[model samples]
Target: MTEPERLRADAVRNRAAILRATEELLAHHHPQQISMEQVAAAAGVGKGTVFHRFGSRHGLMRALMQERAQDLQTAITGGPPPLGEGAPPRARLLAFLGAMVELVARNKGLLAALGPAPVATAPEQEPREEHPVYRAWHGHLSRLIHQQRPDLDDDMLAHVLLATVHSEPILNALEHGAADRLERTLRDLVSGLMPEG
Candidate 1:
């Protein structure tokens, strides 16, 4: 291969190796305790490669989170319902929240280690309506909302409803002793807010 092509291929390999190592280690341990050296050892790459690929520990953590978000978006879009399909709107909403809660529970250590990343940024010029994952969740929720409450603006309601489901306040509630209560409250909220026929 040409020299430039070979370098590109190697760069891709390095990034993949680093991400895989980070995911595996973070799955069982907290990010603060997993040093760059340990990640390199786990990936069987030199420590220099980890630094070169990710620039710093924080960058690595951000990449891991972005990867996870993309994976979760796919699974929820295509995996199975109530998470994926075939369930009632309330059931689907509950399942989605439950799945998120379980994921948070499983990754609590890693999350505590990474700290809060800013939740919002400048909107991309590309219309989010055209994005597959955005459309999937928004479309599903919109349809369900319209079915229950035709008087409400489905798009607006879907946005607000999902924002509540994912907001930090709700996550905090789940992390504390209020997960069950929160779930019931969320279902009740959805029921009450949805339009009656």
Candidate 2:
């Protein structure tokens, strides 16, 4: 290959190596404890290569989060049953929440190892009405509820149902040995949210 082409290939390899090392390290050690030298060594590349790939530690962390978010979006949109499609709206809603709780549990471990970094709260970026996941979940649930019971306020009901199933609090309870109680409470919550006889 030409010299420039070879150099480009090498850079690609180095970037991949650094990202892999960052993910592995982030899984087990806090980000503050991680250093460019450690990532370079782990990636089997020179320290300078790590810097070239990511300008700083925060940049690397952002890259990691972006990658994780992409992976999660893909899984939720393409993976099995409830997550993808092929279940009743009510059942799928429950399943989606359960799966999300499990995912948060796993991610919490990795995030903890990455240390407590402040997350930017973006209230303005809430999913739009047409976003596929939002539409698929809320629209489908609303349809199902309306089909079975036309009297309920579908929009408000769907929001309340989903809001209660958020994963962070669920993960906290699970970590605190309150998983069984949480499960019972979730069931009660779900039942209460549904249209009454």
Candidate 3:
């Protein structure tokens, strides 16, 4: 490859290395505690490389979230029965909630590390609806609810359901040793809302 091509290839490799390091750290450490310097060291690159690629710690987290969200979106859109398609509306809704719980749980660790980001007087204060991952999730759940129970207020129900799976609430439950209980409760909540035969 030419010099220019080799340089471009190195950039790609560096970007991948940074993301991989961030992901591994996210699994075991809170986002706030894991600094850009640590990530650079873990990735075996200079700190400049990390800053050049991600810009900031928040940027890095956003990239990690998008990566995770893409995988989840793929599963929900075309992977298989229940989450994707080819199931009854009620069944699909249940499966969707189940899958959502797992997704939230995986990301909840990050929040556990964050510890009450942007604290609000009300429980519903945290709203990240504009993020692509969040927007896609909200749209999918809202659409599913509308399809099954047209009479109900779909927008309101969708917001509330998604709220249940948000990072703060999930992390709180996990902290209290109630993660399983929370999942079961979410299942029950969604199950109750499903339209009857």
Candidate 4:
């Protein structure tokens, strides 16, 4: 391959390594405590490389979130069935919520770190509404709600539903091994919103 091609391959590998290292660190350490230097050391890359690639801690967290949520995004866009394209609106909505439950459960630490802070928060923090993953999920949910009940305010309702899954209550349930109950509650909530005829 050409020198440029080799350099591109190296960059890709380095990116993957950095994300993997960040994920591992998030599993054991709070997001606030995991510095760029730590991530660089863990990934076997230079601190400058990490900074150059991600720009800042927030950028790195966002990149990690995108990487983690890529599979769900692909499935939603193109995969089959309720989580994908072929189901009814209510079914699809429920499936999406269920999938999000699992995703949030698995990545609670990272999600908490990336979650929106209060209005008075620092400027560097990204709000949940502005995050790319949140936007995609909100858009999907809003579309599904519109399909089911055009009379409702789908945009606001979408935010409400997303909030249900991302809230402290859901996180606490997952921590307490009450995921089954949590899923049931979510199913009930969605069903209530889009009741069958």
- The 10-residue segment of model 4 with minimum total lDDT is 116-125
- Candidate 4 off by > 4 Å: 115-127
Question: Model 3 over residues 139-172: C-alpha lDDT tens digits?
Answer: 8888888888888898888778777755565567
Q: Among all windows of ten consecutive residues in candidate 1, which has the lowest summed lDDT?
A: 116-125
Off by over 4 Å in 2: 1-13, 113-188, 195-197
What's the C-alpha lDDT at position 151 in model 2? 82
Off by over 4 Å in 3: 1-8, 113-127, 167-170
Clashing pairs in 2: none
By TM-score, the best candidate is: 4
Per-prediction TM-score to the true structure, in the order listed: 0.63, 0.59, 0.82, 0.84
List model 1 lDDT by residue over 39-63, tens digit each.
9999889999898877788768766
Put down candidate 4 lDDT per residue, 45-122, tens digits, no spaces. 999999999999878887887776878999999999889999999999889888877776777677667664211122
Where is the poorest 10-residue window by lDDT in model 2?
A: 113-122
* Model 1 stretches astray by more than 4 angstroms: 1-17, 27-29, 113-143, 153-156, 164-169, 177-180, 194-197
Each prediction's whole-model lDDT (CA): 0.67, 0.61, 0.73, 0.82
